[model samples]
Target: MQDTTMAGLWALGLGTVKAQSTVTKTMNASIPTLVVLANLPQLALSVIYVLVNRLLSAMAAAREWASFAHSRKGLRVTVPQGQQRSTLWLQLPYSFAIPQLVLSALLHYFVSQSLFLAQIAIFNARDETEDGGASVSSIGFSAIAIFCSLLTTGAVLVAVVLAGLVVRSEAEDGT
Candidate 1:
């Protein structure tokens, strides 16, 4: 429970930093319009993923700790070398839930940053410089990038939902 709490807090702090960085970069960019528009999809996706992930994390943590309290008499601080067994099923919430949430948060941040950068590149490519910039061939790259990121975020969201379902089933079974 302590570990999961710490991980969740760390994810929250890291996500805030990343969001601020994204906003700062977008504000300072030469193509504010393009950057802002490009960020819209990612921003919506981030909000959805963040909310769902946080809820899953909290629910899993609560259930796991409740199970622990119920089995307190059988609980031990550490498993012996030859007897690596215990009543606590720590892997589900600790290994899967918290890490996935953190990964989603981190991935969302980087993908959003990449989207902003790609838009800036595309906007710059349209300039009338002597050396010239990217041709029309690269114009669709930003859209493709945004689409790919959205797809990946959707897949992760599905996985988180599945984890929540597993937690719910386990609770029902009294496991």
Candidate 2:
């Protein structure tokens, strides 16, 4: 599951690059170097996201097992010694998993939209040629998009904390 999630994120990054290239082509602009530099932080974020996701999945599974054990008096839940029958998705509730998936998608979309390559044509009055002036291309940042991406990131972090808290509370109550 983790590998699949990481692969999806990589595919999303590639798609964003392709989309940016298309936009740049339409505007007759070259991609800025800063765009490549910007990806480093995104890569780091993706790594962090994967790790946090793994942690949250484990917590969710523990919460599920705790609930099961608590519901049945004098019953003990033991961790699997080897291969497990159920996957992480199966352990997580739909209400918890669905929103996490949605938030992750929104986060990626907003992050990709936040930075863009933009071209502006500079026209000169002195030049009478059809193409009077050169075009200036640069990396542009959208404030609103950045803000939204940050908000989505915050939401993911909050979800992790909430999940951890739920697991901790469950463990305490089960004990």
Candidate 3:
């Protein structure tokens, strides 16, 4: 759920930028600034991925602790031995980790596709034009980018729903 919220917040920020660009049509910014702006989504998504991964690890630990507390086997160690030692990444089953990794990749790809800075030269129609033309630059959004972003969000939502179902099933089965 936290991961979903993070994705939603990112989507909201993208939508806000799109709306602003649509209304203004142009934004004055330096090349360096545009470059930084273009990469911001990637940075934000990376942070989100780390936070979500940690959240999943914590959830797995809690689930394991609950099971151990209730088990009739008592204080037997749950941690795996040898090279398959317990760690943050090892806490989650591959079933959960793989989808999360795929979704994170998709999120990064879709976000990179969705927004970018574009510079276009504009010519003046007036005869009294001094410089004859000027360049306008702004962030641009594409329909396909919007579609990709929404698809990624939907995929994340579906993953969350599936995880919930798995947890519920495990509880019912006492496993």
Cα lDDT of model 3 by residue, 54-110, tens digit: 777766655666565456433323585654434445558777798898898888877
Clashes per candidate (backbone, < 3 Å): 0, 0, 0
Best by TM-score: 3
Tens-place lDDT digits, model 1, residues 1-175: 3233544434434212332224343443355565566567677766876577567657776667657644543333355344344533443445575667566776666566444433222234446533345321111123333344566667777777787787777677667
RMSD of 2: 11.8
Worst lDDT run of 10 residues, candidate 1, spans: 135-144
Clashing pairs in 2: none
Q: Candidate 1: misplaced stretches above 4 Å?
A: 1-30, 65-70, 73-93, 101-140, 143-147
- Report lDDT (Cα) of residue 91, candidate 3: 57
Whole-model alpha-carbon lDDT for candidate 2: 0.62
- Please list the C-alpha lDDT of all candidates, in the order they appear: 0.53, 0.62, 0.66
The predicted structure with the larger lDDT, 1 or 3, is 3
Candidate 2 lDDT tens digits, 16-131: 33322333333433455656644555776678767876786788767767777666533323443344333445345676778777887888778777666555566567654346
Model 2 compared with the native: what TM-score?
0.60
